[model samples]
Target: MSQLITEVQPDVEIYIQSIYQTVVQRNPHEVEFHQAVSEFLESMAPVIKKHPEYQKYAILERIVEPERLISFRVPWVDDQGKVQVNRGFRVQFNSTLGPYKGGLRFHKSVNASIIKFLGFEQTFKNALTGQPIGGGKGGSDFDPKGKSDLEIMRFCQSFMTELYKYMGSDVDVPAGDIGVGGREIGFLFGQYKRIRSGNEPGVLTGKGIGYGGSLGRTEATGYGCIYFLQEMLASQGLELAGRQTVVSGSGNVSIFAIQKAQELGAHVVACSDSSGYIFDPNGIQLETVKQIKLVEAGRISDYTLHHPEASYYEGSTNIWNVDCEIALPCATQNELNEVAARQLIDNGVIAIAEGANMPTTLEAVHILLANNILFAPGKAANAGGVAVSALEMAQNSMRLSWSFDEVDGRLKKIMQHIYQDSIEAAEDYGFEGNLVAGSNIAGFKKVAEAMIAQGIV
Candidate 1:
C-alpha cells in the first residue's frame, strides 16, 4: 500500500517520490503508467546522484508527462452494413532525442492508460537503440482479430483519416504493434498515401518489403531478444546452446525468438497464444508455427495439428509451469506475474528475457532478481524491432535499401552495443549484473542530458 519509490535512501528517495507522486496525482488510476514510471524511477536513485542537474531541471517530472495526447473517434462500416465507432489514441510522450516514434497497438484492451504506459516505456526503449528517435504510441480499442479484410481496411482508413495530419517522415512515425501487423500497416499506409497524395514511405515502419520496408524488420525484435540474451549469457560464461527454452506468445517476436534460439542450438519446446500454449518436447517447428500462426492465422493449438506429439494446454499462464532453462515472455504487459516468476524459478529457469513491453510484472522481476536469474528487461532485450525500424527510416531517407545480411549484421551490432552499454552502466554504478537498473539509467542519462541541453520546452 505504501509508495515503492520512497523506500530508498532519504536524499534520492525524495526526488523519485516527488516525481512519482506528481505522476499518480496528475494521472489518477493509471496504474500501468504509474507502474512503468515507477519501474524506471526506482532504479534511478544512482542516476540522480550522478546527475544532480536532472532534478534541478525537473527532467523526471517533465519526462513522465506526455508531450501531447491526441484522442479521436474512428467510425467505419462493417461487412453487414452496420456502422461501428472506436476510440483512437496517440500519446507522444517525449521527443528530446528526435521525432516521435513508436507502434500503434490495436487490441480490445487498449485505453489511455495502456497507451500512456506503452508510450512512457517507448521513450527509453527508443533511446536504448542509440537511434535518433523519440518515444510515443497510438492505438484504438478496435479488435481486428475477427474482422474481415474489407472491414479492417475501412477501419484503418478511418483511423488514418485523422492520424495522417500529425505524422510525417521527419515527424511522428507510427509502426505496428499487437493486432496491428503487416496487414493493418499496409492498410494504414495506403490510406495515409491516399489522403496525402504522395509516396512518403518514411511515415511508418514495419511495412511490407515491396514498399520500402527494410529486410529483417519482421524478425528484428525476436532475433534481437535472443542476441541480448546471448550477450548476457556470455557475460556469465554460458551460452544459449543446448538450453531448453519456453517462450510465451506466438506473435512475431516469439516466433522469431524460437527461430533464432533454435538456430543457436537452444531447444525451444513451448510457445503460446491467446487461446493457450503448445509444448513440443521435440522442439517447436518454426515453419510449422509460421504456417499456423502467420499464414493460416490460427491459434497455437493448431501447432499440435501439425505435430501430434506436442501437447496443448488451455490456459495462457499455464505455460510458465513447463520446466525449462530459459523463459521468454514475448506476450503483452504484466503477463508474467509473481506466481509465474516463482514457478519459472522453481522449475530451474536460469534466465528470462522479455520480448514484449513490461511483460514481467514488477513483483515477478523482483522474484527473478532475488533468485539471481539473469533478467533482460524489454527495453534492452527487445530493442531490435525499433532499431531495425530506425534502420528502415535511414534506408528510406537515403532512397536505398540494404541486403538482408547487411541489415541483420547492423542489428546484431546494435544489440551487442545495447547489452554492453547496460553492463558498463551497471558496473560503473556499483550494481554489476543489474541490467534492469543499468538500462534505465543508461537511457535516462542520454535523454536527460539532451533535454537539459535543449532548454525547457
Candidate 2:
C-alpha cells in the first residue's frame, strides 16, 4: 500500500481494500498468498491508470474472490484397512472466456488460499494465451509421496467422487501440477468416467497419451519458457548460443528448460531441487541430469554421483550469484528475492523468465525492471503447459491426434503471440520494452474487459 501505487490506481484502491479485508478474515496466516496478491495488484498500477473503467467491475475484488468454491470430504481406506479422510477443493475462479481449465495439485501444502491464488493467476494466464478457456484449480492436501499404488488410487477415487459432480468436458477440466501427475490423472479420470457413466474424453487434460494427452504436454511449460526467452532475445538480435544459464527447480518445467536450453546451444550451469542446488561450472549434461532426476527420481545430490565436477549447496538463496546471462526460476513462489535480484544484476544476468508462479518478489521484479533486464512473468511465459493442455482437450473432443511437430508448432506460436502482446502492452503503457509491465497490463486488460462485459458475474 504505497502512495505511488495508490496514486496510479486510485479506483483500484477499493478493490485492494476489499482483498485485505478478505485475506484478514479468511486466511490471516497465509502470508505467501497475501504477498502474491499484493505484488500482483501493485503491478497493475499502470493498467488502472490507463483503463479507469476496469475499476467499475472491481477486478481486484473479483480476482480475489473466486466465482465458485467447492470443498468436499474424501473418505478412503488405506492399505492397513484403516479409514483415512482428506479434504478436496476446486476453486472455479473464472470462466469469462470459456470453460474452466487448470491443474489439480495433490500436495501436502494444498489449501484453500494456495488454490485460490493459483486459480486467480491461472485466470489471467489462460486469457493471455488468447484461447477459449477460463481459470479453475482443484486439489487436495493428500500427499501422494511414498504411498502405495492402491492407497493413491483410493485417495484419487474418493477425491474424484466429489469432484466429478462439478467437472465436465465443456465445464471445468483439470490437469496435473505439482503432485497430480499421470498416475493421479489416470485414477481421477477413471473415477470420473465410472461415476458419470460416459466416455467424455475431454473432461480432463494431461491424461496418459494412450488415453487423450497431447504429445508435448509434459514438456510444454519448460520448453515454452525457453521459447519465450528465445523470442525476447531474438527481438534484441541475440540468441541462446554459447550463453550460460541457471535454472532453479528440477521438476518437470526446470528439467525440460535445461534440456531445451542445451538444445538451443546454451550451457546450463546450475539446477536445484527442494533440498538444495547443484552447480556445475563445466555445464550440466542433460542426459546425466535427466537420468538422475527423471529415471531415478532422485534428489539433486544424486547428480554428483555421475558428474563429479558438480558441487551441491544445501541451503542458499542467491542462486543467481553463480553468474550467468539467463536466469530461469522454475521453482516455487518468491524463490527469487531482492538479494538474488541484486546478485543477478551485479553478475551481469541479462534476462529472466519465470517458469514458476510469481517466482520473483515485488522488490526483485522492480530491481529487474529498473535495470532493464528482459523479464517475463510466469502467467505470460509459462502459460504454454496449460495452453497445450487446452489443445489436448480440443484434440480429445475431435477424436483426433496431432503429430509432435504439429502440437509443438502451435505451442511455439501461442508463446510468441503472448510475448508480442506483452511487448505491445508495455509500449501502450509508455513503459516500452518492459515485459513486466507489459505482461501485467496485457493480461489485466483482457480479464477486465471480459468481466465488464459480463456485468460483474
Candidate 3:
C-alpha cells in the first residue's frame, strides 16, 4: 500500500516532515516510494495548518502506508514444459473515498518500489478524477512479451486463482497497465469468473467491449491527454489544431493520442517505440502505425516498410531532439529527464501533456515550468484511462453500456473539469501556472477531507 493530502502552506510544516519521516522510516531504500511521498508531502504544508485535525489523527502516517499489501506466488508451465514462478502483488493503498481501483501491470521490472510509487500517485490521481474510486495498484514480475498464448493464459489463471479470494465487485477492481492489455484482461476476467462462479464484470475493468467494457475505454487516456491539452491551450487563447506535435511511445496511450490530435488537425511528426522512432514530416500516418505496431506487433523500424518517406532512428531517446510545438510523453516513468526537457524548450515547444504516469523527471518539470511552458501533469492529463474504467464499472453496475460518442463526451467533460479544478487549486494556494503543484493540491485536498470525515482508521 502507499499516499498525498493537501491544503496550502507559506512554510513547510513540522507535521508534514514528521509524516514524511514516518514513510521514510520503513521505505528508506525504496527511492521511488521516497520520491512519490516527498513530492506529495512537500506540497501539503499549508494543508497541514488548515486541517490540524489531520495531524491530530495521524492521517498522513496512515495514508502513507498501504491499508493492505497482498503478495503471492504465481506459477505456470511455459511452452517448453518448464515451470515458471513469478511474484504477484496488490497494494490496496486506500478506500477512504471509495473502493480500491487501479491497474495491474505485468513486466520483468515490476517490484515493490515501482508498485508503491504507482499506488501512491494513484491515490491523488483517482481523487482528481472526481470519481468514487480510491487508490491502489497491482502487478507481477512476469514479462508477457515473448510468452505464448497458452503460457499467458496459464499465468493469468494462476495469478487470479490466488488473487480471486481477495477481489470482489464491491471491493478492489483492477484494469490493465504496462503488460496487462485486452488479451491479459480477457484471460484474467475469464479465470476470475470461473473461480468465483458469478457474472461479476465489475470485479475487473478494461474487459473486451462486448463483455461489459465501456466504449472509448481504450482510447480514453490518449484522447483525454489531448483534451486536457486543448483546454490548457484554450485558456491561453491558443489552440491545438495545425500544430506540429511529437509524441513518445507507440503504445495504447500514444497511438490514440496521435489519433485524437490528428482529428483536431494537428500534424503529429514523430513517435517512438522501444526499438526506435518514426519521423514523417508529412505527418504520421495513423493507419501505417496501426498496421506495424498494433496489428503486426512489430518494431517501429518496420514503419519504413509501408512508408518509405519516413525515417526511423536506432533508439527512442533521440526522438526527443526533433522539434515540435507540443510534446507528449506517453512512454514510461521519468522517460523525459532534464536533458530532454531542455531539448524541447530549445525547439520552442509551447506545451507538454503527459500521457504516462510521472513521465517527466522533477528537474524536467522544473525546467518546463520556469520557461513558462504550459504543462499538464500526468495525474491530471492521463487520467482518462481510469476515468473511463470507472465509467466501465458504472456500466457494469447499471447493466447498461454507453455509446462511443456518449463515453467520449463524458470523458472530454471530465478532462476539462480536471484541468479547470487544477487551475483553481493552484491559484488558491499561490501555485498559479504550476500544474504540477496545482494537480497535487487539488487531488490531495479531496482525499484528505474524506479521510478526516471518516475518522481515524
Strongest candidate by lDDT: 1
lDDT of each: 0.92, 0.85, 0.88
Q: Return the candidate ranking by lDDT, descending.
A: 1, 3, 2
Model 1 gets an lDDT of 0.92
Model 1, 181-297: lDDT tens digits are: 999999999999999999998999999999989999999999999999999999999999999999999999999999999999999999999879998989999899999889999
State how far residue 404 of model 3 sits from its true place (Å).
0.6
Two-way TM-score contest, 1 vs 3, winner = 1
Number of clashes recorded per candidate: 0, 0, 5
Give TM per candidate: 0.98, 0.94, 0.96
Per-residue lDDT for 213-242 in model 2, tens only? Answer: 899999999999999999999999999989
Q: Name the best candidate (by TM-score).
A: 1
The whole-model C-alpha lDDT of candidate 2 against the native structure comes to 0.85
lDDT of 3 at 390: 92
Q: Tell me how far the alpha carbon of residue 206 in candidate 1 is from the true structure, in angstroms, after superposition.
A: 1.1
Model 1 alpha-carbon miss at residue 223, Å: 0.4
